[model samples]
Target chain A: MKMRMLLVAAAAILYSSSSLLMAEADGKWLARVPDEDKARVNPLAGQAKAAAAGKIIFEENCARCHGVDANGLHNRPSLRSERVRHATDGQLAWMLRNGNPYKGMPPWNSLPEQQRWQVITYLRTLPPAGAAGGKP
Target chain B: MFASPAFARVLSWAAVFLLPVPLLRAQEKPYFVTYSTDLEEPGNLEIALKGLTASPKDANAFFSPTMELEYGATAWWTTEVYAQGQATDNDSTVFTGFRFENRFRPLPREYFVTPVLYVEYESVSRADKSILEVTGHDGISSFQVNNSQSHPIVEHSLESKLILSSNFKGWNVSENFIAEKNLSNEPWEFGYSLGAARPLTLVASSQRCTFCLQNFDAGAELYGGLGTRYSFGLAQTSQYAGPVFDFRTPAGVTYSFSPQFGLNDNSIGTLWRFKISYEVQQIRDLFKSPSKRNAQ
Candidate 1:
């Protein structure tokens, strides 16, 4: 009985420590996504037409905080960074659905699913870090 | 393909309305009560100097200049104080009493339409023609003789507006429905404004230029008085419509100009409005108290 109780406490502590570490990662927001969501792929990816549509949506809805070029403004995070570039399509979509309010990002869940995918499609076209055309 | 004359006219108007819809939006103060749902950055100060000069067909020309100090108290809240004065040829220049105003936005994110609430308290003479808050003044002659008949006694009033704004396809459209009441005695009066504006260009050049077309915004507005609560028709109405031009400098200065033409005999024949403002919102990191700094 004594040994079982000791093992239970140990397991709880280990579980809590891992959660803390995961939430502390760069962007920290990455840990919030469940496995199923993190692996989903964008249906509209690589579609030039969808990307064109996304640009309009982004300008009207996202440009105020993320900036017209998606370079970020008013200390908002730049969507063209490595974290965004490396993030899976599902992860991006999930973030939009469930915003990290603590970080000042409002949920775009009100947007239609296809519209969200379209935004992801547009985002993928942005150059990675160190790209010449990126904002200074 | 060009269509018939009537169709062509309609298409031209549509093009004018739709061409700039995708341009990004920036905060700009309008000439009239047409307000966009833009809140100032947190803890920033913007000082604006604005003047409007009106010409009546057979009456004296007069101008009212107002100095407004606005502060962003929070992300969703802005507060302002105004001191107004008017001058007319062969008439005394009187310092109109001051006004206090506040605007609040309830939503945290952009939407198809955003609604903002505006409330203000003003104390001014009956002859004040700043038109900052258009209430019951319907005749052009009222503005012509405003500065001449300045009474020592001041009148207190409350004004409110339901400002509904929408940002879609990069175009921003705003409408203001206004109601005002005198503190002493009077039925609630009504007024309204409609405006549409967008930047001339949306694409930012890689090489920076100061006077680029992208920095200018051109739009038009229509506003008028809608009479009192008891009398809800256009029996004694005044209306005006005109183009507005705004230029924003990289150094945080904005200049706005507008020339308005009245549509009725009761309205002023021509009205010219100008506004210049300098904003100090960028130095937030260096300063601890912006309001205190402004006070100094």
Candidate 2:
């Protein structure tokens, strides 16, 4: 048990100092998205339950960084901001597929293209810069 | 102690219960040998227990358990440390040494075939049975001797891989080219692996419930050695191919399983492997930022 305690203590130390480096913010990724990519359309755009289905995926994959309300968390940017609210569905899809890695956001290309669009569909439902969560 | 089945079970159970308390991402791949281009989210840590059991025609049946702790320090880098152990049915269990690995993606965005560079340092005994990677005539002499005879040959090696992966529609295809060199005057070893996987369903159900078709992935991988630099062929090597399955829970837990069949005379008849992993996101923020804590 003493060894286990020592391991726990070491882990606590690591957990505390591990933050010495972490994810941060970037702005240039929006400009880097190719026009062709920006033109890609969301196939699930107008489906009635698309946003509802997207909310489930958004909560599973993005809520940790983006917040359940899509208002953003820590230093991560909010999806409810005017920039995101006005982003074309294709632009949002491009961002999801190609993250702002020059800063710290990892790409979500591992997710299916459909899931990326689904999350975008869900993002469209969030109110701008508020503490509300709804999908209708 | 770290390699025992009991210890592995305890760790897996702990991850299942403790790691799923909050929401997390679930785009993990299911391949056991081939790596894909997905890196852990930055500032997140993942803990996992992986095990392999195989009955080699040459040696006693044994189980090897590996404990892995992976951390994402940056968007393009994920680092992992592993503790390994092996136990035979009639023979005693022994703790093999450790391995440290880092995978880096230099690009800032997606490419036609995303590339990930991997480097790992391993200090393990000859008795090591995890068989994490098969490289260069490994099966010609693998498991040919008893653990007592092999355990004393402690060797240190450097392993590297060039991983290429692409996702089209809902399917993911990946390939890995491996090179390993022993620091103690051994020739370079080469290996390769290929994998393809897709989610059972592309469309997600509105409810985030377990047992949903979208939560599962099915895949397969083929891996084998390609002999040493001096003798560069498959003249004496082991090969295996197998199907893989992965189940991702909404609460940040992942379970993976595979059963591989050896494809050559030098290979083990069959191998079964399983792993359980948990993702803990932004743990630093969880501790340091009161504002972020409130938002969560």
Judging by DockQ against the true structure, name the best candidate. Answer: 2
- Candidate 1 chain A: 10-residue stretch with minimal lDDT: A16-25
lDDT of 1: 0.68
lDDT of 2 by residue, B1-296 (tens): 24656446645654665554445543578988899989878778887778888777856778788888887767787878898988775566788889989899987788889999999999999988888889999883657677788888899999999999989988899999999999999999999999999999988887767899899999999999999999998888999999999999876678899999999998898999998877777666666667646742
lDDT of 1 by residue, B183-293 (tens): 888888888888887667543332335687656777898888889998876667888889988987665567789898888878887888887776554224243355533
RMSD of 1: 15.8
Could you tell me the TM-score of candidate 1? Answer: 0.66
Error of 2 at B126 (Å): 0.8
Question: Which pairs of residues collide in model 1?
Answer: B21-B170, B21-B171
> How high is each candidate's interface RMSD, in Å?
13.7, 3.3
Instruction: Tell me how each candidate scores on DockQ against the true complex.
Output: 0.04, 0.48
